[model samples]
Target: MNNTPESSFERCPVCQGSGSLRHLVTIREVPYWRCERCQCTLMDARCRLSPDDEQEVYRLHDNQPEDPGYRRFLNKLAGPLLARLAPGSEGLDFGCGPGPALAMMLREAGMQVRLFDPLFYPNHGALAGQYEFVTCTEVVEHLHHPLETFSLLDRLLKPGGLLGVMTCFQTDDSRFANWHYRRDPTHVVFYREATLQWLADHFGWVLEIPAKDVAIFRKPLSQPPVPGNG
Candidate 1:
């Protein structure tokens, strides 16, 4: 039961499903919608930034690989993931940002990590290779096409592979208007805890909330049927 009227019906970008989306907030005159089904909050397509503008915003981030604070920030996702993996497993740091500090951290733990960032380190070969796990740290919010991006991750992982993601969960609509995370012009999507669970259920992956802002999903050994294959 969507509280908003049928006029708000726009297919959810994440799930590509029919859902009622209410106008959640308006920041700097940019409207964002919240889907009742998946609980995904997405910026209006008209409010999206141009490629050049997006790149410029990413370029301003100071997350150098050697920066101590940045390294600590990455450890939030890396530490738990390292503990779960088997010895010497290979992984991909998806959307590793310009610095790729998470890749560095994984390498330090004796795992082979390949880096891929659309802007900073574009390596098609890395995406083609299968990995035991994938890390997407602080990356999902900036995704313009999350369903495709996540499907790509699904294809890149081997059986029983892990997908670890870190992002500030969107909670409380009243607080959203002034939320710091939503202020970033490049962050176009927001996820609630339910949204993450919905993704796991949709994809047949096992979901776990390991820590604040961190969600881990493990792929089943056997692939599930495609949505319409039955």
Candidate 2:
């Protein structure tokens, strides 16, 4: 019996590259694929949970502002980001979960933060303006349309602004089947360090890995002029 996954011929959701996806693994009967172009692993679309079910999973989380443990966990991303921002930097907490603890933490550091979560604090207006920084902790894995979502993230930043992302970076394929991060039904996409670099190159942003599972991208103050006969 051939165990190989039949050719998907589907474009990679992360980088929109075609003919580069190959079956990576199946856990608990759910299929996942890895993109050769971007090194992003994505769950089969057929296995995705309904919106209501996905939201319910998020609701079960207890990441509150007062949870010292959670605060420490978030500090991995926050500490590095705070060091780079100037005083009173305006920012947005994209995909801040039910508790919005990260936003509260940043606010405590004297930064102004607006919140936006499709499930919890969905305020469309919050995305209308750009910001000096944007934090997206544990959010990229849930993106169903990464290309469009990332494009939106890019637009949400001001020139020379920072965009911070935190997700369990997919490593050690030998343990992928048992990886705790991939077991969550809502976490449909996984990124490798190479994958993050692809995003930085594609968006013309400078990339920084200040800590494990954390990536910070800085948008250029101004885009360089396209090559032309001058």
Candidate 3:
């Protein structure tokens, strides 16, 4: 039932909107982009990952936080985030991918972790519960409608919840041209700190940039003012 039309967003033709561009290197062509707002290099848009294609890739990954290497990598976000969570926190791993590694780590930390991934864990019912935290590790870059996804993540949060995200930010134009991260066709939309700031401003949430590749946004305990209301 992968009904997403291939041309829904027109493939961001100029940079191909692959969100990366290709550079002619001495040995091989390199892919990257030059962000208009941030002036950072990135990848040029390529043929997108069809829903079927994305699912295929997920089927191949095997990771769990119990794996020492996995834990070591995840703790980069988990340590700081764990410190912020209250005991018995209930949370969701929005894009758990194949192994649900982060959920495993969160559960290990005593939080009740619910997992969701459109392709693998399709228990849509989990979305019904409110969470004190939501983590989308390396997931936002693949989002087609980041605003829509963020809104849903926001709605799924109880007041004062933390939304933790991890994805490399565009830093220097020099590196983007050959950055290995862009090789994955699934990654699309790139984010700048300002992008997160814009989201925080509009939603009335507080934003924090703890790691170079991670962001944590906190939803205020009170509801944000209704749109267009003074």
Candidate 4:
């Protein structure tokens, strides 16, 4: 008896209930699933962890403060972002986690970096206004509401400001159940390249896939496009 109420998890929380499954993909023999509704790949709802359960899991993470490899990985976006930004660019590290390595990196680059994480930093005020740049590396998948969150981010940046994101895109017709990402219950929403485009169009921003798992959207000061992009 699969009495588990799917609605209890909220209707396709990723796409605000309107989003539907687009396709599925496999990563390392593990199956992954995506919603066409939001073009988001996700672990099924049954895999979800309660709030307390997730917090306990996070406590177990040992993200080293000085990991060169991690820095190098983050550089996929940071490198290009630094190039686009001037010194003193105001930046926000949404979902900075307990160890905010991303925020530190931007601060090191002479940017004014603020952090907001529901648990660790927990400063909703950081989203109150515009920013020169905003980074959500390895964060979007954790969102229970991609539509709302992304829209908020779009509004948070000044026209011509930058929004950076990093999350593996879900592919089509492949392995899913064994995907390592799905093993983590905290990751709820999945994304696709087309999904980003949907966002670009919806928000009137420029979207770029600078590297695999790395996405950037820039808002233009000019009039919005009839066929918007992101």
Q: Pick the candidate with the highest TM-score.
A: 2
Candidate 4 stretches with Cα past 4 Å from truth are 1-11, 17-33, 223-230
What is the per-residue lDDT of model 2 for residues 1-230, given as tens digits with 9 covering 90 to 100? Answer: 98766644368888888788989887777778989999999888988999999989999988788999999999999999999999999999999988999999999999999999988898999999999999999999999999789889999999999999999999889999888998888999999999999888888889999999999999999955322211
TM-score of 1: 0.93
Q: Once superposed on the true structure, which residue ranges of model 2 sit more than 4 Å away at CA?
A: 7-9, 224-230
- Candidate closest to the true structure, highest lDDT: 2
Ranking by lDDT: 2, 1, 4, 3
Enumerate residue pairs that collide in model 2: none
Candidate 1 lDDT over residue span 1-230, tens digit each: 75432333357778776745777766776778887878999988887889999899999998889989888877888888988999899999998887888888899889999999988899988988999999999999998888888889889889899999999999889999889998898998899999999888878899988888999899999978646311
* lDDT of the candidates, in the order given: 0.86, 0.91, 0.70, 0.75
Better of 1 and 2 by lDDT: 2
- Tens digit of per-residue lDDT, candidate 3, span 70-164: 87787778877899999889999998887888888888889998999888788799888889999989888777666668778889888999999
| Model 4 agreement with the true structure over 73-101: per-residue lDDT tens digits | 88888988888898899989988887888
Worst 10 residues of 4 by lDDT: 2-11
lDDT of 4: 0.75
TM-score of each: 0.93, 0.95, 0.79, 0.83
Displacement of residue 212 (Cα, Å) in model 3 is: 2.5
